[model samples]
Target chain A: MIDVRKALFGYSEWRWIFFFNKESWLSRKSKNGWVHKKRHSGKSGMALLLGPLFRSQNAPDPPPPPPTPPPELVWEDEV
Target chain B: MNRQLNEINLLRAIACIAVVVTHSITNYAKTYEPALFDQDKFITYFRFALLWATPVFVMISEVLISKNYPNGVRKGFLLKRVKYILVPYILIGLLKSYMHSEGQWSVFFQRSWEIVVLGHWHGFFVLVIFQFYILHILLGRFLQKSHPLPPILISFVLSFTYLYIHAGNKEYRVFIEQVYPFWDRTIFIGWLFYFVVAFYIGQNYERVLIFFTKHFYIPLITAVVSYVMMMNRVMDRVFVSVKSDRYDMLIFALSVFILALVLLRMIKKPNHTLIKLSHFSFFIYLTHQLTLPYLSNLTQTVANTFWSHVVILTFLGLATSIGWAMLFYESRLTKLFTGRIKALDQLAR
Candidate 1:
């Protein structure tokens, strides 16, 4: 009952789905504007550092925005 | 202690070592010398060979959990998981975070939260295992009275589609990365099939074992072919950080099946070494991430050649992980986190 062929190569029909980029999804949905949100800490920052190595081969996006300091830290420490 | 469970222990032992060796080769080689990782043929094949480690661990987890809760989810089982898995996870996460910051109180809480959520180093595997545990309970209830035919078929379609789409889909990957960026593999969908398949197999343990044993060549051939295909794909690509693709999962599941069949037949008696190592596997899993980088640094400083350096690092990393686990195993605190009175009871229980 194992469909080896399908298991190995069944996503051909939806291959076009792969091409529908998320950036386009973002742009089309946001009629007015969208903010470039900042990741202050946690795994997002780490991924921003290491994402290039494991990113999809088909992606055309630029590097992620630099992480902004947490608002609390910024407020307390800013000169 | 039962003969029936010996094979699972052996599998765990092998899988843990594979994980350590794979991490040592892939991470260290990439960090210290990228070209060597790229150019070296042995390292590539070695990584391919050992790539099944994490998936196999996942499968074993599903199998054991399914066995315990054959009918459906149990409150006791979930509570035990909280004790054995989540508690140690927090403890180990905090410990690693504190160490990473060298006891700096400022960053300790933030770092600990990161470590616990995203996992410190390879601790993401623990999170993946936890996710699978949760999925198993939820799915088991819906799947309680079904004939098991529908679920299997559904998992097949869902799992394969998931793999194919994720592997190919660029936008979805980016979206997922942006949204659930806490160690992407920890997502249950990526490993849905492995856990589901293992759950089914574990439920029908005897029949499946016999089937695999009788027609072993089918799986053997499947694994070999799949591995060859994956390796070919990896070689074709310039970037070599290939974790488990879908093909890799299929091959590894088959391989684990084949390995279980062979081990069950070949070894009637318990191998004390494997059992002992298996007892400490989770302990080692927690501590190995911390130990590997230090060992990698040491090996880089001490060893002369690439081959020698990698070999030293791999074995030393394995030994140090086991040693750390052994220290914890013998210590009085074994009962506190592990929930086991004696060391070997951790495996046997």
Candidate 2:
């Protein structure tokens, strides 16, 4: 095992990745990502909010950049 | 140790699982036409899945209310109401609206009432909790005083009545109609039944404990069968028109029984981690939706295939949920937010 207590002295990229951009890199980038994955993850109220109704694939792709909902023509009703 | 388990609490967790399935199935239906289960199944059978999910919440409310103010219902303490129920409800709704800001600021605000009051129509869960609070003292007295049969029979009749009406009434509200329709307490057609059921079931401490410990598989089988029957709309004509209230209580009974059993058994050796996880279950439900969109945005860049995306999302979902639970359990935030009320504080279990 790379004695992490000793590895703390490492410099440059190690320090940068270690300190600055930590969680995203570690969770998404570094190989140990899976082991040290974020505990609170990709859940939200909207999922529950819109849930038990719209069943997506276990985890769907990032929803194709979320195509904007068509603009409602509120004024058209008055006409 | 075998007996002390809160079966109702266990069923609450079962409700959590059902919510997971319901959401999963709902997403599938919205995106793809044919779902794992038909739309109708959700109301008739699966909707019952939600029955326990939130009414267990009602029981929780009654228990908490009775514990806190045993005398009479507080007239209208805005601050008190806001502290627990209102604050969480509004804050969560606002967070949902902000995250899901589907349109312009005006549009979101226009619908904020919808979200705040209705919560994707699932808001009925909160309303039901409020209903329980309003009825707590009375309901508690009723449960204490009356034999279980009257409430049970009343709830049964009311549920059947709702099922009959919902079926006969052809007009669709879109909002009230789930893919499959039925008389559901969550949507409040026959909610009185479920509310009373929760109250009654909650009152019998020994029966609750025994029920959970005794017949575990019956519920498991019932849930599985209910899922199948409702998913297929097999009982529609006989039970309800669009969907059926056919065997909802049976399903709930099974779900609750099984859940109580599981919770009792599992809780025997609940370590710190499990306790912590259980502790955060509510927050998990409350906040998970907030976290998902952010993760979706972040991961869209890195994740390649649909499969990989889902894996990441699932992993992240579990991780973030646990993380949040851990944070709350370990942090000062729980205390800070909860205030000085200590005894009725939600247990990790």
The candidate that wins on DockQ is 1
Interface RMSD in angstroms for candidate 1: 18.0
Which candidate gets the maximum lDDT versus the true structure?
Answer: 1
Measured as a fraction from 0 to 1, the native contacts recovered by model 1 come to 0.00
- Residue range A23-54, candidate 2, lDDT tens digits: 33333444643233222324333344454443
lDDT of each: 0.65, 0.48
In candidate 1, which residue ranges exceed 4 Å CA deviation?
A: A1-79, B31-39, B102-106, B147-149, B245-248, B305-311, B329-349
Residue B315 alpha-carbon offset, candidate 2, angstroms: 3.9
lDDT of 1 by residue, B1-83 (tens): 76667788888887877777777775455555544325666666776777777788878888887876788766687677777
All candidates: DockQ: 0.01, 0.01
Local accuracy of candidate 2 as per-residue lDDT tens digits, B226-313: 6566444434333332211233543554355446545555654534443333444555555555565566656567675444544565
Q: A1-79 in candidate 1: lDDT tens per residue?
A: 8655334323333322332322333324335443232223312322344556544344467878999743110010000
In angstroms, give how far residue B113 of model 2 lies from its true place.
1.5
Q: How many pairs of residues in model 2 come into backbone collision?
A: 31
In candidate 2 the C-alpha lDDT for residue B6 amounts to 41
